[model samples]
Target: MKSHIYITRHGESQWNVECKVQGITDTPLTSKGIEQAHELAKKIKESGIKIDEILHSPLSRAADTAKIIAEENGLPLTLEPRLVEQNFGEYEGHEWKKYPGVFHEAKKQFACDYNGGESMLRLGQRIYNLLDELKVRSEKENKTFLLVTHGGIARMIHSYFNSETNEEFSSTNTGNCEIKEYVF
Candidate 1:
């Protein structure tokens, strides 16, 4: 049987609410984010989605979100660095929306590359590898899983499952604990 997988971006962090770029630097979730996660747990229960295992990025925000979901669903959670967000390099602490270069960079969509950091191509490959491992486990062991990761990583995951189309597939602003499901 094909496995059903769920991918989620971590709840809103202090940095996220502040409109700062939170690349590799870890941040804690806001109070609203905790509430969001709780709501997500309720949604999962209502939907009756059975998560066999949970995987998270090493980042605290992602890890905490995964932990909450796994606890609510009684599933085990593991950390996977490959699922971490793309490193922003020089742009790490800068407010991209306010910073001229960052603002300009955002408009380019897929053509833009992060300054002195991982390229989109590389980010895609990392997520692809994580999914490949998940695919093997699901196919061979018949397990379903959830992955908690960063926004950039989540975008890559969405792109992978949706296929590399010219048009970007953006997730609705998934608040803390929001669940985005994919069955394959």
Candidate 2:
């Protein structure tokens, strides 16, 4: 049996509003972020889709969003460390503009590491491994899942399914609380 995977980025974090890079740094969600999570829950409930489980990154922003969705849908929530955002290392908490060169390098090379941070290739592998595990589990149990994660993870997931080039993968982006579907 194939399972339908619904993936979503966490709502805007306090750092997002402040225009700071969050990369593994924890922050509370802004008011709009909370509202966005609620809206996502409403959309899922209205669609009447059955979700067997909810998995989320350990970060507060993603965890909070998962909690809301799980409570609303009466589903269990699990923390998935692999779903966390890429660690930007020394760049974390800095203004995104300050790391333009790092971002440029990432777009050009999957192995690019931002100032001692995780390489894009490693991040991709981590997520892919998680996906592989989930795919097998879902197939055996005939289960569908909802994944709550960060923007970078969401973008990576999109690239995993849709991109053929590093540029294409780098170009992918996800808005806060946006939901994307993948069939496996």
Q: lDDT per prediction?
A: 0.76, 0.85
Cα lDDT tens digits for candidate 1, 1-184: 6677888888889898888877898889988877777777677778988878888999888888877887887878888889888887666777856775543345235445666777677777788888888888888988888888877777777776776444344332344555688866
Clashing pairs in 2: none
Model 2 misplaced regions, further than 4 Å: 97-107
Which clashing pairs does model 1 show? none
Q: For candidate 2, lDDT tens digit of each residue in 50-112?
A: 899999999999999999988987889999989998997766887767666566455456676
lDDT of model 2, residue 83: 94
Which structure among the candidates has the greatest TM-score?
2
Q: Candidate 2: lDDT over CA atoms?
A: 0.85
